[model samples]
Target: MDLKETHISELLIAGNIDAVKTLTQQAVDDGCSAQDILEKALLPGMDIVGQRFKACDMFIPEVLRSAKAMHGAMSILRPLLIASGVPMVGALVIGTVQGDIHDIGKNLVAMLFEGAGFKVVDLGADVKPETFVQAILDHQASVVGLSALLTTTMPRMAEVIQAIKAAGLREKVRIMVGGAPVTADFAFQIGADGFAPNAASAIEKAKQLV
Candidate 1:
């Protein structure tokens, strides 16, 4: 990477949102393509952030700050990226299942998916099963991610799956489940396509699912 690109990545990892935004604008003004900025700078920085998070070297607050930095840079790049005809990796519809108001994990996964190039439609917490069905149809999403922080809400994940099947949309998308109370066995029992233990793995799982 060139010096400017390297600086962009460094600034992003450091959670310097203003610097990231300013340098990203400068890079674009200096003739850098939006794709180059995303691929070489923003994504690489987030890759390191993910690694640190997995290794316990970074905490949630730190990772969130980095995500904010990435968000700032993306604000400048997203329109240009769309205009440049760069295809998204896939579309993802994500939400916290009904009766589950916790969304920290879901939000983290959404940001990670965004960093990894998926177009994410976040339905927020307490999302109804029918909402998931509607969002899948509306977005033509390739992946559906459900999160539940409570064991009680875990069954809601199955309800959403059943609702998708009832709508005949089960085959149209891959379903992945996660959160503190979720397990691979639970995901299997619910007929979900995959389970992610955390936000970082969610990105990998989404990629594999698509």
Candidate 2:
């Protein structure tokens, strides 16, 4: 089969790992740059997968499979992509707030940021404020992304922001918050520098805020 960009994306979505690897390698061998395969095929395919996931048209299994396919292709392209001189946009530390075990949003945002060329340090779910502060200190990150899927845990977002501010890291770092129940106004109320409705917008908001 012809390994067009669309075809490559379809293979990714279908979770045809071997097919994806073969087609992606073929695309590379056919005089296509790995970056072209990444930007045109893999990243765009993940974008669609994420959107479908958000819309409930696709579930976690499909998303994970697509991510796996993307990962496979990226493993082959990393050195080439790095040598092509695409600099990282910035570094980020991300986590779901304390008491919140929901990480789907956090994971999505992490993926989007990575695709957007930002180096992300994921702190995982149920992260305490001190954990985030420690991550910031350790990573020396420019942006901190907080995700909370529950209203009860939403307050922890503010707490984390406050802790960061109290530790004198607030001025140096940009704080961005997201999750189902969070609003722009709440972001302001909680002293967050930025807010986004979802992962894509979170990536855009991070760019703007940083």
Candidate 3:
């Protein structure tokens, strides 16, 4: 990494939102492209945050702070990225399945996906199966993520998957499932393409699926 890019990465990991914003702007003023800043600094910083979170070296609060820093930089870069026709890694449609009002986990995963450079369309909690299908089709999303915190609600994930298949949209998108009661076995049984135990792993899984 360039020295300035390395500094930006460190600042991002440290959750220095203001510093990240300032340095990113400076980098732009110094003639660095938005894509270069994202690839070399912002994304690398979030990658470290993900690794640390997975290793238990960082907790939710810390990871959230890092995510905030990344968002700060993205606020500046998003329009530029659009203007430059820079494509996101992938687009994802995520929601907590119907009958499940729980959303903290889903929200965290959405944030992590955004930080990892994916365009995320969050449908919030208590989402219907048809809503997931519509969002996937509307966004032309590559992946669909389902979250269900209760065992009772877990079956809703299967319903969503079934709905996608019934609508002939299954082949167009990869389905990933997770939540407190979700397991890899359950995900497989439901015919989901991938499973994640937590938000960090969700980003990795989404990347692989895409």
Candidate 4:
């Protein structure tokens, strides 16, 4: 039987790891490009999962399982996706600001960006301003997301932004700030290009920026 697209999405949404693996391979075998599987199946499925989570219809366990399933499928699809030369939506360097170890939010944003077709270079938590600047320069990324869960570390967002500006990279990079204590006003005050309340919003904002 042909693998139905809906079935692939259902398997992903329900966190059916084995079923997703099998069906995804079948999709590849059927001549479906890996990018097609990612964009048409995995990404849409995760979008639903994210919506459910936002609506409180899905718990963290469910979301995590779905993410795991997506990850598994992507592992099989990466080489093909890479070979296809599908231009990425954009490139992003994301990190939790200095002095903050919180990464859950940052990781979520990274995943969302990846799903939305951005090439994400995640600079793990407690990243210094210079690191962000250097990564932006190295990757030639147009967007940078700074995450901070603590009030103390939130100030580092401004520092990072200043560093980017001082390095003459401000004109080229769109800086987005987020996390529990981060506010739109704060982001503006820090000269960030955007601010988001959550990962989903971050993706939306990044799209707008680029």
> What's the TM-score of every candidate structure?
0.62, 0.63, 0.61, 0.62
- What are the lDDT figures for the candidates, one per model? 0.85, 0.82, 0.84, 0.83
- Residue pairs with backbone overlap in model 3: none
Who is ahead in lDDT, 1 or 2? 1
Which digits, one per residue and each the tens of the lDDT, describe model 1 over residues 1-210?
273534888887788889999999988898888777876787778888878988999897888888888878877876676565434798999999999887656876776677677888999999999999999999999999999988899999999999999999999999999997799999999899999997778877777788
- Candidate 2 residue lDDT tens string, 1-210: 234634988888777777788878778778788657766787667668868988999997877777777767766766565455435888899999999887756876776687678888999999999999999999899999999978899999989998998889999899999988899999999889999987668877888887
* Model 3 vs truth, CA RMSD: 6.6
- Count of backbone clashes, every candidate in sequence: 0, 0, 0, 0
Summarize candidate 3's per-residue lDDT along 1-210 as a digit string, tens digits. Answer: 264534999998888889989888888877788778877787678778878987999897887777787877877876666565334788999999898876656876776677677888999999999999899989999999999978999999999999999999999999999987799999999899999998779978887888
Q: What C-alpha root-mean-square deviation, in Å, does candidate 2 show against the real structure?
A: 4.7
| TM-score between model 2 and native | 0.63
Minimum summed lDDT over a 10-residue window in model 3 is located at 78-87
Error of 3 at 155 (Å): 0.4
Could you tell me how far off, in angstroms, the CA of residue 168 lies in candidate 1 after the best superposition? 0.5
